[model samples]
Target: MAKIWAKAPSPCIGVCKFRDEGRCLGCQMTKPEKKRFKRLKGKAERRPFFLMLRERLEARDRWNYWSRMYRRRCLKKGADCPLDKLEGAEREARAA
Candidate 1:
């Protein structure tokens, strides 16, 4: 089940350089993925996109830096971060 949000913020952290092949060094989203995110309307779509983006960041070992910046962005936008909830759930799953 995807976590619903009143408003999900973009995963981009303004570091738009495509330094890692086609992925952004900041959010690990490609240009098309970024555009796709902007086109998504509801929480169902956005949340999954965020999760996928997080996975991409993790694959690149960039989640640490990107998560911090993304959390700040969510704070500034008054939006709930998908990473927070997802990470907590992951920890609980591991514990049990």
Candidate 2:
């Protein structure tokens, strides 16, 4: 049987300025991706979104900042964070 999981919350950190035509400087989500994120239903659906976002963050050299913000978001929402899945993020969070 397939295990169903809740949809992860949006990663927006309230900093909505777009650094370019499609990318947001805050959450690092592209405009289309942001829209898709809002409509996505479950963990199965969001996995790819997070993966894409992670790549964007890494590309922009903002993984550390995004990781910290995401952890805070998880704490605020009482949701299980995917920090451990983000490479080196868990350790970085622990050290801070």
Candidate 3:
């Protein structure tokens, strides 16, 4: 079975005491929509959850284009992304 946080109850404190710069420590979600981010960590499977995280963060980036939007998709899953496709996701935001 999955962990309790994965179950997605009232996990986030919403006070956002854990925000580093514009990201929340709970899910490392950005400031614009940290509240919108899932309180639970993402699932292991590659599906809508991952896509949603990508979309949400990308949306936030679009809203704040003047700021530095470093592509860091791997951080979402603790993996490595040398190509930084997630970094260039600004294009995705534009299309949206």
Candidate 4:
């Protein structure tokens, strides 16, 4: 069964750019975030990292920049939002 926070909210708006390779233009994550996503060890340990990445995204002053580019990416698909899927438990616990 899907856990309470089993999956994180996807940043994607139906714009997948990683279908060909382990790379994306929409949310430019490296091969790691692109491939081998389902095998993440734990959500508790991974949420902070994604949160950091999100903060990084929001902190950027550039309108169209690279860091801003992939900060959103960090994942290849929705229902599969890497940030949330990888770190949901940690995120939930953090708020508590």
Candidate 5:
């Protein structure tokens, strides 16, 4: 029997404009990464991608914004957010 897999949700925030640096102004994903993201399957495949995206967002100083949006998206989907494991600061910020 084939193993069932759960797909990781997209990190897009609906702001698709590309910056001059060739990254998305919203999600911070590069055009090529965004295209490849659509073709990726399963959490196993997407985990590393999201980790890299988080690093990119951190480099661009957009980690907090992305974390909040990601949490909201997880809530909306009634899914457990993997981000919670990596973003304790986001929870504390919200509590404040």
Candidate 6:
């Protein structure tokens, strides 16, 4: 039997229009990043990708929208939201 994934799925929130220098305004992921995300098979592999995406979103001041959207997506999918694990000041800082 395959291991069940407790983690969130792809960061994509169904908004695929690429903008901001090839980055998707929805998830801040580029086309290649989206493809790479698909090939990641486990939590270990996917966590780094999410962290990277978070950084990118922060850089673009997009975390407010993307984080809220992603949290909703994770809830709807019944998957564990990675953002829920954010710690202390890091979490608070990002919430800005």
- Report lDDT per candidate: 0.80, 0.72, 0.40, 0.44, 0.74, 0.77
Which sections of candidate 3 miss by over 4 Å?
A: 1-44, 62-96
Cα lDDT for residue 47, candidate 6: 64
lDDT tens string, model 6, 1-96? Answer: 112233457899889999789988789899999998878876567667777888898898989898899889988988767776544437789889
TM-score of each: 0.82, 0.75, 0.26, 0.36, 0.73, 0.78
Off by over 4 Å in 5: 1-5, 85-96
How far out, in Å, is residue 68 in model 2? 0.4
lDDT of 4 by residue, 4-71 (tens): 12454333333456643453444444457634444443455345545654554445432245333334
Cα displacement (angstroms), candidate 2, residue 73, comes to 1.0
From the highest lDDT down, the ranking of the candidates is: 1, 6, 5, 2, 4, 3
Model 1 stretches astray by more than 4 angstroms: 1-6
lDDT of 2 by residue, 11-73 (tens): 787788887656788888777777777887665676667777888788889988988988898
- In model 3, where is the ten-residue run with the lowest total lDDT? 62-71
Candidate 1: clashing pairs of residues: none
The candidate, 4 or 5, that scores higher on TM-score is: 5
Better of 4 and 6 by lDDT: 6
State each model's C-alpha RMSD to the native.
Answer: 2.3, 5.5, 9.7, 8.0, 6.1, 4.7
- Summed backbone clashes in each candidate are 0, 0, 1, 2, 0, 0
lDDT of 2 at 31: 73
Task: Please list all clashing residue pairs in model 5, or write none if there are none.
Answer: none
Give the range of the ten consecutive residues with the poorest summed lDDT in model 2: 1-10
